[model samples]
Target: MVRDRLSWMRFCGLGIADTVPDANTLWDFREALIKADALDALFNELDRAINQAGFIPRAGQIVDASLIAAPRQRNSD
Candidate 1:
């Protein structure tokens, strides 16, 4: 989904032509977090912050973003 979703790619700070990490890289990163015993803490803090911000977590929601064409500005040197 991230590969095809502009919103997801933007949220991940990846441009359209950027290379997304494969499953093995993600798994290795997760394993490193697990080894460091930070996964639960990371998620707990994220959940806490989300709830504090009054965001209700939902699943299977499709998010989209649109790009608006803007006029190019010219500056005098």
Candidate 2:
């Protein structure tokens, strides 16, 4: 799923995976966000590219489950 997002980001002209700033250090992470924010316009432009690519944003399937059942399962089990 992450791969899909990264691929989408690339398609939006944000950049290649390796070309993005290294996020090893706090400074790096901050810088990466700055770069991403600076490219926000480019990302928004993805609406056209995505449409051209035949992608329409729809709600994705629920992959993460809620934790409400966890306590009940533990107690019942």
Q: List TM-score per model, in order.
A: 0.63, 0.32
lDDT of 2 by residue, 1-77 (tens): 32347775675476554444333664775678687785566667877787898998765667776555434445553
**Best candidate (score: TM-score):** 1
Per-residue CA lDDT of model 1 for 1-77, tens digit only, reads 77889999998899999999887888999999999999999999999999999999996898778888999999889
RMSD of each: 12.9, 9.5
The deviation in Å at residue 18 for candidate 1 is 1.9
Model 2, position 74, has a per-residue lDDT of 54
What is the alpha-carbon RMSD of candidate 2 to the true structure?
9.5
User: How high a TM-score does candidate 2 get?
Assistant: 0.32
Residue 25, candidate 1: alpha-carbon lDDT: 88
